[model samples]
Target: MNLRLYDTAARSVRDFEPLQPGRASIYLCGATVQAPPHVGHIRSGLAFDILRRWLQASGYDVTFVRNVTDIDDKILQRGTDEGIPFWQVAMRNERAFTWAYDQLGCLPPTYEPRATGHVPEMVELMQRLIDAGHAYPADGDVYFDVRSLPEYGALSGQRLDDMQPAADSDAQIKRDPRDFALWKSAKPGEPQWHTPWGPGRPGWHLECSAMASRYLGPAFDIHGGGMDLLFPHHENEIAQSKAAGDSFAQYWMHNAWVTTSGEKMSKSLGNSLLVSEVVQRVRPVELRYYLGSAHYRSMLEFSDEAMSEAAAGYRRIEGFVRRAEESLGMPESVPVPDAFAAAMNDDLGVPQALAVVHDTVRVGNAALAADELVGAREARDEVVAMLDVLGLNPYAPPWAAQSDDGAARRALGPLVDVVLAQRAAARDRKDFAVADALRDGLAASGIVVEDTPAGPRWSLAEEI
Candidate 1:
């Protein structure tokens, strides 16, 4: 498969060629662990997850590294506010992020190295830049000298002269105002580690550069994060990594933001929809579908109406798979359609790929209506395969029995059986009125009961 991706650094879509013959490496900027992940944050993970799935589907060994910024200014502040240790605050939010990722069916990363856990790697990276004359230690703080690197703004496409001063750290002793902190000086109440320069925590950008190099090697294939990180975060990463004489990421991929009311969804905006909160409104699978329905590069506008529409859309695909499985056998190992593959290869065009899935669902439903079980099974197979690639397969584990709605169905099964048994006794006693009442009650509760040769089977009533 000739995979293509839009490199944020190049500002153009290009064919993706892995550095290794049959292996691909990806470094996704993971959570900072200051708070539970909102949908806006998890969207980046979902986008990269789809990309990883596609690469694996296309027959490449993928090594994915998604790191956690467990030590940050915000994390320290949160701990101070809560009157707890910084690691405790970080660990609490980190578990929340892990839960959200798993709830959305994202495959776990190959290695999820925490920022605090890799202080040595971060120190080594800072030392390399300092030795290369691109960084310096001042007043117990290490800063990356931005002007020392001629290609500082290459990734973000802004010339160094046109850039604003780096506001990430104090500029008092910097050689240039654009210089950013590599390691911050320790504050009284914050976490700290010993380094040659001084005792301090790694800067946000420095952690990613160090962790990515440690796991994906000196050079990797793709580095990804949200569009908001395009500035100082990723820009500084490029400058320090390349200035240290190591080739960093081959391609830079960034996902667009999840917006609300024409504004970026952020905690400060008071419109942050946590994944845990959104999943309460919709099933985790439905939420994932809503999040992944749009193009990764497109801004996903979050609205209840849009989310409901996406949920309804997924139910259509899911309804077809469930119904088709009953008439035929369980869907497994079907050939993915050429159209779906083409769409995915074209920069992970999920919207187009999902269109192919819905079209196939239409075909499958039509075949089932016509009593063409063979054709229905074939269509179901293809649909299931496509959904599996997108990590939205309803029949798959975690989404299968673990879904809350599915669990409810399991819990209510015995009660429904009792009702059916009562109705059977009413029928035996020639009480048609009572029998009809039980049936009506079931129907009113959205349960449809059918007496088969085996026994009474029940299903949820189809929505109009």
Candidate 2:
């Protein structure tokens, strides 16, 4: 495989070589499930989803494990605020995240392990660290001795002395302020699991390490998450896993955040655009195209204008695909264009790859206009193949069902016809101004009115 990826640990683009031949193992740090996912939250999922699709397209058997942090401080807090059990809070929000992922057409992971369900694995990993003298228990809590590992700060590229204290636990009990908790001591009214040290819950960073090892083994091809997790979460995972004498995460990949008003979109910042709400304004497939259109490593700034522009851009490609299929019927997907594959191989360059998609769309549109069946069919095949790699194939399952739904068109027909009748009456009376106004109004609402020789015809605008 010629695929190369930007490794966060190496701080450079590196050639991707799977640990095992013809197989790729990826563990993506998934949602914490404290609340419904915002667009910012789902961006990471979509970014990694593209990677998963590309790997499969490239002929690698991929094992993708995306873990859920079901038990966390925020989850507990949300439960308290809602007057419900923490488990209930976690489950409700987890479903929301799952829905968001599915709505955007993200492929489900090979194993979606929850942290609370894997206590036994966490306990075993904690025991290994303790026996190896890299972790110790104090006051019913297990803490990883950060100084024990000489290469502790390698992942984050920070010197031990310059680093800030690990704020995961109280400084009074830890031997060093930098030591992070493997297990937090059980607190009143909180969930707990029995461990040799005491009854407590797994720490945030510890959950991922244990879950990744459980499904993908100790040494896997890649570990991925958002850029915000690079400091404490991913760095801690690296220290604990390596200190336990395991070669974990051969390559580290972190996607950039979705920002709003120059700030990272977060609930605390009060700038998050929820996936459910955003999809109400735009089609789910259009939202997916907007989010995945940018490079995975580039920060995508959110704006209504930007999103509208992206929707228009996607509509152009979809327009060509639909037109070509009408002229040439459905074409079998051929291998992706060389330019598209080359861009994808170069560190998942979606921006460049999308350029290839648009270029093909242009070619297909020209072929259709000239009534060249052979050229149109070839372009359609290439376009479908490229879109499939990017997980944006409109003719594919999910999106196809969405596109072919007659119920919506049927429901909308009567209302649209009423308006069309009024417009026709105004036109018959030579009230051109009123008729044009009504037609423009319908177009603004994404309804196109065509005055044909047979009769007036109405259809939903493609851009919407």
Candidate 3:
């Protein structure tokens, strides 16, 4: 099980040797809880899940910690706007995120600590930062002074002098423009806790630092998140942790963004697609295949053609699964090809890994047709084992509901009725334009609006 991963700190791939003998600790940044997760978020989860599954399979005891950022300015604002407690909005979306994770077949972490639940730890961390002169109190806010930490920009590789100040940051809280907050003073309508400094909440970066250290330890194996957080988010985490005179983690891993139509996929962009919505169309397992078919560090631009290809690819695996089941009566042992292990060991090169899957399926199918059940089962189990690395269990989907698809379609009756009425009005007025537009709108919402003789009938779209 010799494996190596690309380390962001070193800017290169190195052999992954744990500090202790057979133990791996991972601290992956989880959802912010501001909104439901989009396709972009699933990519990071799947990439790390690959690492986690690999380590676990290699006889290593892995402690994975993925935090839920239940407290943030956006959440506070949303709660205020909706007239609900801040926790309400975060909890609602956190559940949605978990569903999305299930839909995408991403394995859940060992410890999912919420940011709000660990305020005491966060305050303790802030106190250490303040005592070490790495951070200071300014007007009720505690800020991490970027100039105070000499190696501040190491993670992002950006120098303090060369960087421009962030426009959205609090100008008064920072001694220098590059400095960021460790503790945010509670404003009216925002959630707060009592602390020695004042009544306030933990800043975004410090929450991860505190939660990660508490769960994974001061020094751990990998700390991963999206590449966009490289600058102030991860850089600030590095500074605060080091200032506390403790190492944060061994390898820094950041997954690249997901793109759609040449733009970064995001809910704010209105072009973002939800993993749950996607699962409604295709088998959630196939969505995992589609996402895992690309390199972790490369930007994957998703489209209908790519999805169709993934569906076709998944059908091949399904055929192998069905064939393996049929040939269980024969006697022979098929071996898993070395190509699969080789590709997977190379920093989870799933594109190549999937190619190995194809080859294994081809070989196993030939053996199965020749009445070799023992080897076919072994080969099928081998493929399933590799699939586990990417969090696709091949048995059950995380996003799959216990109820029938028919029942789920019935649940969408009200929404479907609204869409049909709008579409019917457009058709009765002899305006095919509005009718077509209505149909497209319904399809985008995961509803397939079809025009039948009985009128518009709706079902969940297959490629949602």
Superposed by TM-score, candidate 1 places the C-alpha of residue 107 at a distance from the truth, in angstroms, of: 0.6
| Candidate number of the best lDDT | 2
What lDDT would candidate 2 get against the real structure? 0.91
lDDT of 3 by residue, 137-227 (tens): 9888888888887888988888988888678547855788777888888887577899888899888899899888898778888899999
TM-score of each: 0.92, 0.92, 0.83
Q: What is the C-alpha local distance difference test score of each model?
A: 0.89, 0.91, 0.81
User: On residues 1-464, what C-alpha lDDT tens digit does candidate 2 reach at each position?
Assistant: 39999999999999999999999999999999988999998999999999999999999999999989998888888888989999999999999999999999999999999999999999999999999999999999899999899998899999999976556448888878989889998899888888899899888899999989999888999999999999889999999999998899999999999999898999898889999999988888889999999998999999989999999998889878876776688869699999999999999999999999999988888888788889989988999999998888998867999888589789988998998899989999999999999999999988888785457877677553
Model 3: worst 10 consecutive residues (lDDT sum)? 327-336
Candidate 2 off by > 4 Å:
166-169, 408-446, 449-458, 462-464
State, as a TM-score between 0 and 1, how close model 2 is to the true structure: 0.92
- Candidate order by lDDT, highest to lowest? 2, 1, 3
Could you report the Cα RMSD, in angstroms, for every candidate shown?
Answer: 3.0, 3.1, 9.9
Which tens-of-lDDT digit does each residue in 1-464 have in candidate 1?
58999998889999998999899999999999988999999999999999998899888999999999998888888889989998999999999999999999999999999988889988988888888889999999998888888788888889988866557456678888878888998988667898897788888889899899999999999999999999979998988789988899999999999999989999878899999989888888888999999999999999989998998999888878876777787777976999999999999999999999999999999999888988898899999999999999877867986643777689889999999999999999999999889999999999988775456778876443
